[model samples]
Target chain A: MRSFVERHTFWAIVILLAAVLFLWMIFAVWPEWLIDTLGRKKTFVNTLLNGVTLGGLYFLVASGFTLIFGLMRNVNLAHGSMYLLGAYIGYEVADRTGSWFFGLAIAFIAVAISGILLQYLVFRRMAGDDLRQTLVTIGISIIAADAMLAIWTGTTYQFSPPDWLFGAADLPIISVIRSSGDAVYIKYPIYRLAVLLVAVAVGVALWVFLNRTRIGMMIRAGVNDRDMLAASGVNVQMVFVLVFAIGAGLAGFAGVIGGTALSVAPGEDIRYLLASLVVVIVGGLGSITGAAIGALIIGLAEQFGLAYFPTYGVVLTFLIMVVVLAVRPQGLMGGR
Target chain B: MNSSRLFSGSFSLRELHPATIVTVVFLIAYPSFASNFFILQIGAYSLILGTIALSLMMLAGYGGMVSLAQLTVAGLAAYLMAILGDNSMGVMGLGWPWWLTVIVSVLGAALFSTFIGAVSVRTEGIYTIMITLAVAVAFFYFVRQNYVLFNGFTGFAGVEPPTLFGVYWRDPVPFYYLTLTVAAGFFFAVYYCARSTFGLGLQAIRDNPRRMRALGFNITLHRIVAYFFAGVIAGFAGVLLVWFNGRVSPGTIGVDVAIDILVIAVVGGMRHPIGPFIGAIAFVLLENFAIDLIDRERFNMVIGTAFLLVVLFSPDGLLGLWNRFRDRFRFRGNALLGAERVNKDDPASTGSLEKS
Candidate 1:
């Protein structure tokens, strides 16, 4: 019994707390139904939608960060650069070809290739060395940012999404909550809905990929003990390259999505980079579920802050971070 | 010497070599020989930056914590100075006596750093880095948004150095001398403390916290104290930094500046007490000249390249390079003098940890 606790205490406590929080969240959303039933303007709907969308994007970026850091123990500070570069590449492709699909495809491919080469050329040597890897990645990011500035200029650029996913639609589920003949449907944009859906799909797909496949098993094993895995006759180096590329590709994809939803500019890389850090910290490093959980909490907290307290919206995020640190330095998930 | 052996290692705390005296004399006379613009802008500014970087150096070298929040702490000091002392912005300024304000700002910043140290001390390696990064990022955003207290983006201005002892401290010569004196005092203090038991214990923890803890030292308390002392140094520099610029703003403590402090410390070499000072001078020179030499937009890229090169080529920085040259000649002298028998167990070899 004691051995059981010593082993399972980390996950047991985390999942239990998560279940409780999830139930509480469901109850908290019940207020929206009440507000909708009264036929009043559903103010919480927009905030909820935006928060989920931002969280999805944050998850997309941070999962990649988790992948690289978890499997190889490398802290790639330049992951944010990949995100912004993806936005720029996607923007350029969409601009010339008038095809959002092509833009995303090309951006994903380009960033993935860059990630592979970077792993081989730079991060490979500093694989286990955190300090050098951080410094080197920071250098890469600075150079990338400057080069981006030279080409993209410092001005903000908005991505044009394909027309089908661009407009607003009635909140279809709210029909059950509305009173008879007083139907005032909360209209949220389709792009944001699509963003949230895509993010969910990506999360589910990654979960399956990490848990179900041969490569996935190796990545989990590598994260647990890379040297031992390598000694067992697996080409852990190839697995490392694969994970790094995938993470970079995910960041790029998120960049395109983020650029379309909001706007991309010079400082967005650092902003998202910092956001990813917050996500990983709150979620626990090197875990997919942790990133997902962290992204949602951070996303929801930020949106609510922005909605209710417009001026102090930014402070609320940090306040939550401080609370998390002071309360549980290990993070919500208690992952290794 | 035997009585003090446990605290001071093999070196005497009051030992002052001939080179120290020459360096001191040269520094004291630098403003007289140089132009006012050079003395005030370059010399004094570098010392202020150097001192802040030195705080970071102490943590990284002695405490085994590489925190990115030092600049934020310094910015906190600078902002506090504006609020406590006289600021023309008029909204939050207390218009108190200068000395009182200085004391409060330094202590307040130190206290703030102790809190940061508390939050960060539990995590090891990259976790600590991430947590500190989070704090610094949050601080930047909080200051930027709180307009009533921080005056929003533009921040406060017209912060003046005190007219202490009936002499204006902001005059070029006086300001240069003041910053120099502060830099030197802090440098000697760090050198002295490094030889003290507390400093050695901190270094012991840096190398192996488990072993240090086994010996019954409270690691967390020591780290927090180190951070507190570092905060006081950085906060004092922050006060000087505000006076030098005559303003305080969110930009002063931005993420870029925080990272820049890390770069300055790393490039100068983290091992020695004098490394941050050297790094600051190099950084100031780079900042002043990099734009002209490279595409103006790519100034950061140039710094990035230099930093990467240093990390890759010289882990110990410029001081390491100096040691290499000195070691080559010293090896020859040792061979001629029949002192080649010195090995890793020798006290002299403790300083040379860069050997591959």
Candidate 2:
């Protein structure tokens, strides 16, 4: 009984606070039947699931941004353009092949190769020069964005996964919810679950790769000091090429996932770029752990803010960034 | 023979002589030859942008701090003038006269810049850049969202330039000459300041702050003073901008335009005062005319490419190239021209990024 109290106390307090907040919000708004639809227990659980999946997608997008910034002391302003490009590529591939899975594979490969080639060609030459590299990448981003606009024609395109992945289902263990209206009594997309799963698997893979591989060691050493690594006979050029590719690949992967979730549009690139920049700034530029922490905080803040304080929802993220900068300019997890 | 020639040429290029000649010729001939609207609109716009960029050059070029919020400061001054004083129309207005409003607005901008400079100057390099960016973004949101002060997003409209010498100054020719006179005045002021002790001290701080501090310079005060001076320049430009557009919107001060100012400073070369003029003229003309010929959507591609190429190949900027070209060519007398031995390390020194 003591252990139960320990586990439940925090959640019980949170629930009570949430209930008070909800009543306050309802008082602000005119009474409506919509609240009843939203108030169902299953709906709450589904919304929670949806919020986690969204956070998972944000993690995927911010991960590449963090890695590129952390490893290469260069700000890739064009990362947004890469995201947009990846989405368009995936959409077109899916359209042509009539297969979402095949399209995603093609999108990942195409964006990954392009990202690597871009690094090899341009960023490799701009090793020490930070500002110039920023300008060049911005130039590249503008060009790529324009090219995409020419092809995509400033239109928003939405894509849905195959029929099998269209509706939600109940897991064997979590049978508290049963089927209702062609879903498991909670209408949420299965693709969102797929995104969450993929993000988790990729996150795990990246963790293993960074901690357990020779290339990872080289990357770490390169991040610490490229000059020292070069003197120590590591092919620093090859390492940069690999790092840039990996960073770009992660962004591409995120693009496909995000595009499938949020419709692909022309200006979406700038939004993601800004989001990623905010994440990196708040998380600390060079820390992967910081990226995760930052992403989670921003995601939850954004979701909660949207639910409770829609008007100031956007301000919450920026305010947190300012507070973080004020308290610790190095960021939450930043060592240097 | 070499010693005699060097001695004779040493005093040839006086500080104000070339600038005076150019100013006089430009003021007299530009309005006379250029078309009516071109003389007024494009010319006035160029001058205003040039003046704004000049203040940025003082901060970024000399002080080595790139404040993206200069435009924000300018916007603040403009909006304050409209809201707090004679420019206001509604019940919320202060209802003061034009001159008082001008002083208050400009002072307000300076005070705001001082506050920002205090926080930002402590950080170095990219942190400084990001901090300024954050401030600018924050102000952008504050002004855009606050309907009571900035009229929400619509901002104030119908700001009129002050009439002088028995004429309404809104006429294109009058406005053009007005801008020219203002630009020329500020140009000389900045040029003279570069040769002044204070300006030299600021440059010293830029080159090496620790050494400057050891030499007994109050580094923070110097930076704030620089920021105040920059605020005045930007505030003056802000006055011109409101008059030009006849309306102010939140979109006027944006991240893209802030970055555009940086591009202008860098493209003209950060090393010289005249760089902004050359850069501004080229940028304005290219952005306006080039987009007409090409796809409007892809025009940014041209700008982006140009920016990259210029930063990569000619970090010294266009004016530096012009000086080089001028030195390379000779006239009928076959005399080798150009001031070749000017010391770049000296704050008063002219030319490119090379330190003498």
Interface RMSD of each: 2.1, 3.4
DockQ of each: 0.56, 0.23
Could you give candidate 2's per-residue lDDT for residues A1-336 as a string of tens digits? 568668899887888799997655433332346456455444344545666777677777777877887788777878888888888889999988899887788777888888898888888886666656766676677667777888899889987668887776653222123335333333467788888898788778888888899988888887788789999999888887777777887787788889998789987776677667667778887777777778777776666555655555566877787778768777788767
Report the C-alpha lDDT of model 1 over A141-246, residue by residue, as the tens digit.
8778888999999999988888899789986434324455464556789999898999999999999999999989998998888889999999988998899899
- Candidate 1, residue B171: the lDDT equals 95
Query: Which candidate has the highest lDDT of all?
Result: 1
Candidate 2 residue-wise lDDT, B241-316, digit = tens: 8778766777887656766776777778777777887787777888778877887767777776777778777665
Cα RMSD, each candidate? 4.5, 7.7
Model 1: per-residue lDDT, tens digit, B81-110? 998888998669999899899999999999
Candidate 2 is graded, for docking, as acceptable
Q: Worst lDDT window (10 residues) for model 2 chain A?
A: A172-181
Query: What are the runs in model 1 whose C-alpha is more than 4 Å off?
Result: A1-41, A173-181, B1-15, B332-356
What's the TM-score of every candidate structure? 0.90, 0.80
Runs of candidate 2 with Cα error greater than 4 angstroms are: A1-56, A164-198, A303-314, B1-14, B81-96, B134-156, B162-166, B213-221, B327-356
